[model samples]
Target: MSQPKKTFNDLKKDIIDNQICTSCGTCEAVCPVNAIELKNTIPNLIGNCIECGICYANCPSASFDADDMDQKVFGRTRKPIEKLTGIYQKAYQAKTTQEDIHSKAQDGGVVTALLTQFLNEGGDAVIVADLEEDKIWVPKPKVAKTREEVIKAAGTKYTPSPALVGVKQAVKIEKLEKIAVVGTTCQMRGLSLATDGPLKNKKIADAVALKIGLFCMETFNYDDYMQYLKDNDVDPGQVTKFEIKNGRFYAWNGEERLHRAKLANVKPLIRSTCSHCTDFTSEYSDISVGNVGSPAGHSTVIVRNEKGQKILDAAIKSGLIEAILIEDFDKEETLVHKLAEMKKSSHQ
Candidate 1:
């Protein structure tokens, strides 16, 4: 059974004392009703919260607040593992016709399809990254609803963003009940921390109904990406699609012309923090989704929790997705291959 939902005041206390409030003003930006304010790097609830739980749900620092457990395995829990195993046991791969969505998406249309399923299932909202000022280079994380909004936020961020910056506020304002988060492996690690440890808060963890983690090779800094575009004589503004596939950097603009470059040519351009990261797949998340081992335009999904499995199963039943059996992914081998490929491509 689910824990009893907390009131707005209960959530506010958790934020003031427990969570890391990063004064990003994300809660202020996404709140449908002006109920929160940022003061001295902390959110101040100004108006009466509607008990929607949006603020609590979106808080990145909010803890899991269950039984005490090892800090190292915060978000990496048994629940997700059981779910993942179940999915893998029944796993199958198939091609999807949702080409338009797939074309604009970061990997396959799997992320979009999952997000759509959540929205259709009475989910309050989805937390994702968006252009801070309508510029591709400037990403500002935000929670959204409409298909257009999610699409606009689509594509790989390739940067270490404060994507979980708003989670605390969502819980405080009570504006969200069930939220689905799309984040990378590092972000999922942080979420795991929040879900475990003494700082764990029940209100926030319960609010985060789902987490969708993306497979990350590494994230690039915004400045580096812009510089790479300039050096390649490619205008970042004209580029409509950018992807790293088979250890190659693929970019395209308005015309059908495609520019394929080796991944090695771009390694020096990545963020310093990404190199130290070892978890390419977010083991802590409810579901890990990416295109690591799948064919071009196909997503490899690892359902990590019963909640995640239930959602995916429902989507399949609804005909929103198709499943097929494929070779089980050996995580260690896959990582080694990815690293080797990146190394080889970088040398090219």
Candidate 2:
């Protein structure tokens, strides 16, 4: 009575068969020897794979076996609290005005608020994406000490950003004690996959003490977003405020302004992979934060785990956030509205 040995190929087969792979490209990025390539929405494992198990370990969809084991061993199985629940409304201190954080943020200042709290409390680092010289998005996992740096990194990236690229670097280089990560739903799920199984990379998972997930409707490809700017006579260089407001997009570049355009008007340029996605909130995250149904300048906070609640409580105590209770948040209806928007935009 011995357990069967698992091989890399076996793992690969399971991943392909499951059809759960979002193709975030973490496996390709983590391979020490440059063995994996993303081809046709799937990973083409090429080159010399030493079967380091990085690919198998990083595949988010490879958790079927683990889920099964959890059910068998624990007598019952459960997903992370974040995933099981859709959304929750909680109040936070509004010490910083929406204008202060909003002006610096992409849309709402929720991302900046969460990151600032972690950094002020002596958290090691914050992982985020920044605009690059070549117009390509790059991951920057900074060891931030000041609120200024944290604010600088806060904003929404509407592109298919490689947010997970910094996970490995955070583990090996900074030797961080605690790190707060912000990402969309797919990226959070990818991180979740990296934490489980025999091939778990402890450095990446253990260092991530706080997971702040942003609500994602759909992430457009970089080209599509750029084209959206162009079609609307927007100059990428002159762009100031880019926001999704009231089911429409508003762009302000210094004195010039654009308004009342549905996201569907920019449909030709969206990423194809986004259409197949179903998760709007990063279910695996400890807390999911967004501005979906809240007042124009306020953030909607959903605390899903004990860690999330504790972090939020500490932030409030430190006078970093203001709290307010949402009377009724129609989670399902909101999701339906978002989905319909995505579909309408895609068709356009």
Candidate 3:
């Protein structure tokens, strides 16, 4: 029997309605016509559908084979060295050498330092999550071409920003030649699909030069996050920083702690799609960074491929960043694997 034909409506039912849409905006970005738009952080069809199936094909929530896509992009798949962490050449506990970056960065300033070095050395553009003008806490994704702009975009926003949307804007609107994309797991998965899927778009494929993925357990719903803060009598404007660590969500105003909630208390605000995602380490990205296994002021770095290694080496050699071998890579890998399993079992 022939397989059933796919369409945009199928994507709406299987993904959007199922509450598993990552909202990476690939549908809106790759649509032949202006048919898809993000409404309240969900992709909605606003125009006619040609039943071309691009939306369904590109949606990360629908799933794709990681090894197949890896082969297409890099000429081979990552070596199966570990089950949860995928393939990687090295692991390190690293931080920026620059004191100013360490002071302003979210964690260890590694990502901010790396991006600055990459751009200073002729990298074209980078997509990052930055604050939306007039909306202090909300993140709006943008392509930053300068070191200053990249630095300004530092720090993490617990809410999803769909950085691939910025990738779309960069390649099409800005006519950028090469781009580095920094995003969460799902967002990088969308990029992997775009670059190597059967219906790959060459423009999107050629435009991306590097992919940096973040370690994420889940992202929050913007409305729910704001409501949670308001219900607790906390003001968003005064929140100098937000972080998840040691089973708690912390909101700080400079040196003052404004609010502290158990991670369990905040689980209700998590985006539903995150529960179905198993990639806690961004398996498809060139490099992945997070604070899970490192000290309070350090970051865990996974160098996944040669390209990632090259950039990392240059950064270390130039004194842009410093590195130390993780005390026990296996112990940290175990921790990451446990979380990956938790997310995977949620759907079962």
Candidate 4:
């Protein structure tokens, strides 16, 4: 006889209770009965259960087929030497040509530029993390359909938002035909789970058109982080931007650095779930972008597949962005590799 089917209770026991849930909202977004919802950083079951087990089956923290996902998305598994940057066709130092985006972007504005161009070219929507309720630090998932919308969502929020939920909104609620995603490493892995292997969700597989993933060290514990800021005499509302650079976290008001923290001092504030995740550069993404391994005004971009190459090339050809080989690569150690190595080793 067949074994009993697993359900949300199984997810709770295996992932939530163990504190291994990545808070990607994979269960919330893919739930057939709309039974699951994420409140802050925790997942709760609110509606009647259908016992479909999609939530249990698709949660990245619970079940991720890296080799299968790699083979399906890239036509091969990542080689042993490809541990840090994963599989990529090319790597570049890139910056956006759009002045407006450059002004608001955390670093290079390459992500905003590419998404804007894609939307202009008839892409349906982009699901991105946006600041919620005029708060500088609280990010919420958004479905952006135009250039202005995409621009507003530009910049990195150190906290984690369940961005995958926007996929559900984009595909099911809005009935969008083509969708692109801009998210962190865990979120990218969440996408990989939905589009590849035995637990594949056809809705996501058919709709998602691009993946633009950010480099991440970890997601913060919101309460702990807010307390740290309060103790430092920094009010979250006064901050104009939040930045993480060279092992330091900065709260900035335009050109003024309002407050700063050494990464180690804030280690206690990092979410416990992040300790279980090893992906630092969003290796599952078609294109990954980050501030490391590039010049001050540019982002280091990893193009992993034909689709990523096509978009990056088109962005350059359209004068929306410019690119060059990473500077001084032959002269020094690559920062991206070092961080990737650190995160993987420590997390494991």
Candidate 5:
């Protein structure tokens, strides 16, 4: 006998009410009908439901099987021993060649370079985190179809932006083809689930061309973090850049440090749902990029499959980016593994 199908109601009970939803917005994104909306970062059913199961089906936290999604996305399962950061063809320290982009990027500008290349190659759009015009450093999902737009969206905002919602809106609503999605680890998992889950959303699956994941230990609550900074006598306008390095978060104003907080000291401001996530290195992504193990001003890039490798190679050949073998690839992998284990043990 087969198990009963799950609907948004099940999603609400199993995920939202349980307080574990990552708020990646996959549910609202995949809903065939505009029946779902987010209320205070939690999804709620607002319209009539025909019992469609796409919401529950594509949810990252609804159920997750790393091996299953891996085979579906890459056509092969990872070896049991290659469990730390998933299967990767190579790793490198890379940076964008465009100085303006590099200067604005959170770390190395690799994501901006890759997205620019894809768009130039006729990809319709790429989903990215954009800062709201009124909210400094607040991330909102935006779909970029040009190099300038992608560059404008470069850099990291430490809050989750529900990026897959932007992907769905761009692909399903705007009728875009060949879209690339750049997201945090959980958001990447949500994209994989939409493509490969039992629901088999043909529109979403066909539209997505590339999936890039960013390294994330945890994301903070937007309001909570802003208030925390205010309480600590930090002015948002003084922050020229926000970064996490060596177990501390820093807000820099040109050559000056505006504010600094140890990672542990700011733990209380972390999003509650992040405590349920264990994917520190985006194991389900085609390629993962981060600054964790790489030196300052360079991104650690993990090439996971032929597609990812092909794109990286093309970008390098076109002079959009430069790369070199990671100086301490082993050490990089070790750091990634340590964080992954820490998140898993603490979350699970």
Candidate 6:
């Protein structure tokens, strides 16, 4: 029997009012009608609620089942040693071969390199986050169809952007056949739910051909984040890049250091939903990449399945990226594992 659908009121009681909404904006993305929207960093009903249940069902914070997701994505559950990182076929320290990408990207520019390779090989569209030039650090979702579009959307935004909204546009609006999505762990969970979900044939879900997840500890609210920076005497408008590292958050423009603050000071600005997130490596992604354990100009990539492995192999063969493989997992020495443990313990 088809289950009775839960409405946005259920979502409100369960997640939004509780202040645990991740603000990944999957709700807005998957909404069958343009009834939902995010105001500030919270989902608000802008139009009539239809009680479709897709928004609630697809929310990582609302309906995410970690164990069921692991089994669905990898065909197995986490082993004893794989508790922190979900399932991985291999691990590597990787970087982009293009100087332009490496110069502007957040970590190693590997994600951009991957997108370039994907688009070059006939990917119909890609969902990426783009910043408004007039609004400094503000971010919005973009459906990119060309290599230039992918390169333009490079870099990290400490504030969350609903990049998955591009999926809806790519699949339903543009009628794209294949699309790649790059997002943080929570957003990845939402994507995996829609794509590999029991309701698997959703148009937006079926259109996702590649999923690349970034390792994220947390994201901040936009207005509060900017005010915090302003309180530090930093102009948010001039800052070109944002990064959190070694106990500090930094704002930079090219080689010029604009401002920085202790990571502890930004606590009040972090999204409340971050504390509830347990998947640090985007365990459900086909490939997960981040800046945690790699060299200054490289990314730590956890290749999670045969699809990821094959893509990495082909990208390497094409000379689009350079990678060094890690033969075995190390618990004590790796920062990624340590950080993963830290992120997981938050849920307990």
TM-score of each: 0.70, 0.77, 0.94, 0.95, 0.95, 0.94
- All candidates: CA RMSD in angstroms? 8.5, 5.3, 2.0, 1.9, 1.7, 1.9
**How many angstroms is residue 180 displaced in model 4 relative to the true structure, after the best TM-score fit?**
0.4
Residues 80-120 of candidate 5: C-alpha lDDT, one tens digit per residue: 54576777778888999999899889899999999988888
lDDT per residue (tens digit) for residues 1-348 in model 2: 964544347556776555445556567646667676665435676787686666766665554353543333223455333132343334232334445666777645766877888887788788776555554343334445567777776666566555566565565565776887788877776766665444556667678888788777776656667766777677766666667766687676644676448867866655655655556655567777767656666676766667788877777777666766543433334442354345445532
Q: Flag regions of model 4 displaced more than 4 Å.
A: 1-3, 134-136, 327-333
Error of 5 at 293 (Å): 1.0
Per-prediction tally of clashes = 27, 11, 0, 0, 0, 0
Which 10-residue span in candidate 3 carries the lowest summed lDDT? Answer: 326-335
Q: Considering summed lDDT, which 10 consecutive residues are worst modelled in model 4?
A: 325-334
lDDT of 1: 0.61
Show where candidate 3 strays beyond 4 Å: 1-4, 73-81, 330-334
Model 1 clash tally?
27
Candidate 3 is scored at a TM of 0.94
For all candidates in order, the CA lDDT equals 0.61, 0.62, 0.83, 0.86, 0.85, 0.85
Compared to the true structure, candidate 1 yields what TM-score?
Answer: 0.70
* lDDT tens digits by residue: candidate 1, 58-160: 4434433222332244334344423222222223343334666666776667777777778889887787877667666556566777777777787775655
Candidate 6 per-residue lDDT, tens place, 80-122, comes to 7788888887799999998988888999999999988888889
TM-score, predicted candidate 5 vs. hidden true structure: 0.95
Candidate 3: the clashing residue pairs are: none
